[model samples]
Target chain A: MRTEEQANQAVEEYADLVRRLCFMRLKNREDSEDVFQTVFLKYLLYDGTFESAEHEKAWFIRITINSCKDSLRSVFRRRTLPLEVLSEEAAAVPEEHGALLEAVLSLPDHYKDAIYLFYYEGYSAVEIAEILGRKENTVYTWLSRGRALLRRRLGGDCL
Target chain B: MNQLQEALRGVAATQELKEWTRRRLVRERTRRRSAGRKGLAAAVCACLLCLLLGAGGYRFYMSPVSYISIDVNPSLELGLNAFDRVVQTVAYNDGGDEIAARLSLQNMPYQQAVDEVLSDQVFQSYAAQGNGVVFTVVSGDGARLQAGLEGCSGYYASGGHSYLADARCLDEAHTNGLSVGKYRAYLELSEYDPSVTVDDCHHMSMGELQQRLEQCHEGAQSTQGHGHGEHRHGHS
Candidate 1:
């Protein structure tokens, strides 16, 4: 199993990526926090070693996305919440970025993941395809459609 | 940077979440280490218990609790465990060594082993020549010793005598490098002639020892008769 030192180092390096992925998928702080903790715990128990820093970061990305998907699929998370409650929890960023963040969160799950990896994490369509286990063409389509939707929601060329 | 990249950069993880995850990982590692230690301890305990049982079983099966000394011209003893199976064999003379080397008596029941010894070709030849075979059984349990003697006597019904002896004398007999049967004969012969040592008796055949004992008895009887006659004549 990975040592405690390795676990601490992974959490420090990847916590932001995991939290942002969880928030985009689940759209609530409480469930995002749960999946975040679950992701780091899994890293601590994983016995295999990574080939490079890129491989390790890809591992964390895949695991965090999978954990978020599992949390969203749970019956407890299926319960509907007030729109105001969800918007208040999702608005953890600066006031000026809240609108853009909300628009990103509102996209289809596949497009949201593609957009986040492509724009914020600075991954190309090909790299995003590998991380999300999709064809490169599929990732490109998701990113293109996601940006068009974001432009419509914000109603400007700021995207 | 693009506008979206600059906006998304503001939505990073908070300090509280990172701290909570670090504390949780530490707690999980501790729990796993404790469970691993407990599993190791259980495995060690199981191995030690198996070793103890194995050693105890070996001792119970291999230790001897009784002995049967078969003495003719060949003097040897068979050591029996609690189940009356032969666990050891020791020869006190060259003939006995040959007989012991020729027979596979270990783990055989005492009665079957005695039959094997008595029916041996060399032993039968001596018996055929009218040499007396003596069986001396030594055991702490009286009833078991008597039962063993009875079973031994049946093997050589005419040419042998079977009797019980004290277990304590067995150690003394071994110290003098003799089987208990020969040792008993030595004790009797020593009474008649103090010059007769255990080594002399060890080399002597059982037939020679018996003959010498008989001569001693006759000499004592004749002396007593002559003394009584002389005393009666004086009284008259």
Candidate 2:
């Protein structure tokens, strides 16, 4: 039974990570916004007790990714905006790292997601596979391919 | 692209969705709390029902609703737990403990239970004085146990709720082939005679009473050793 204060603290801590993960998966603001609300709502109502804070954090990450995937497969999935238009048109990244965000966003969908989780979230290939519900070898292949793509965009061995 | 980490980390949940999620969470928590309360109440009710049933069963098991009380030198009461089971066979007097040990009547049915008790060698020892056994049978159900006592009815009459019936009557009735009930009814209406000792007449039947009168005449003619007039005096 999480108290209101505890739920608020959780929202404060994980909201950004979940929001960015949603944006990465959806690549469109409207769909991302739907998943953002959905994931946090799920967190607040989770019946199981977590063993530790890390376990709780991992659970939130897994649910956010799964919720994004579910929204993509939902009945409302057909009504979609252009992924290219959103990436080029949405320039909400801060001035300090505008170029990097734009480059990361420009990578292929699978490659970009794998790269984001591996680099930014500090997850190993095995852990990313578990969260994404993919095979470990597949996650490793995605990371390898994604890093090669990011190297081309960075004009250096970014790995 | 290390700055990409900073860029992504700085991203926040939109203000509208945060408010919506919080409001929905509050509503969900309230619903869950109510369901939990209902479950707790149901569990409490079930426990109370179990306890109520348990107490009722215990009360029914312990109550002494029906039994046969046989009182002799050491008066005793045999309690029935069920229709065919003797749950408690205890003595009510001081010598009761000693007499009760000889009784192999526990768990026996009503018909055979009494006969088994009376036949106990130790019980017979206690009744050597012929302080005839007293029997009082009772049942809450409208069942009268007087009939169908079989071979025992001849020796033991349908005594009052409690009656002192001579033990010797059992032997006498056995010898004369008489039912104890018919014999006692006859004795109640017979005349006393000097030939029969007063002690034996305590339970002597009326048929036996007539025999005593005939013996009185025979003794006067036959026995000159004791004066016939003195024998008559003794009888009087």
Among all candidates shown, the one with the greatest DockQ = 1
* lDDT of model number 1: 0.72
- Expressed as tens digits, the lDDT of each residue in B154-230 for candidate 1 is 34242455555677778889999899888877775676677898878866788789778656644543443233422
Kindly list the per-residue Cα lDDT of model 2 for residues A1-159, writing each as its tens digit: 578877878888887788888777665677787777766666655545666887677677766765665564341223434435455324556776666676666565556678888888888887776555456786889888777766767767554
Give the TM-score of chain B in candidate 2. Answer: 0.39
TM-score of the first chain in candidate 2 relative to the native first chain: 0.80
DockQ of 2: 0.10
| Collision pairs in model 2 | B187-B206
lDDT of 2 by residue, B111-130 (tens): 67767766667766655443
Regions of candidate 2 where Cα sits further than 4 Å from its true position: A75-78, A82-85, B14-17, B31-236
Could you give the CAPRI-style class of model 2? incorrect
- In lDDT terms, how accurate is model 2? 0.56
Which sections of candidate 1 miss by over 4 Å? A75-82, B42-236
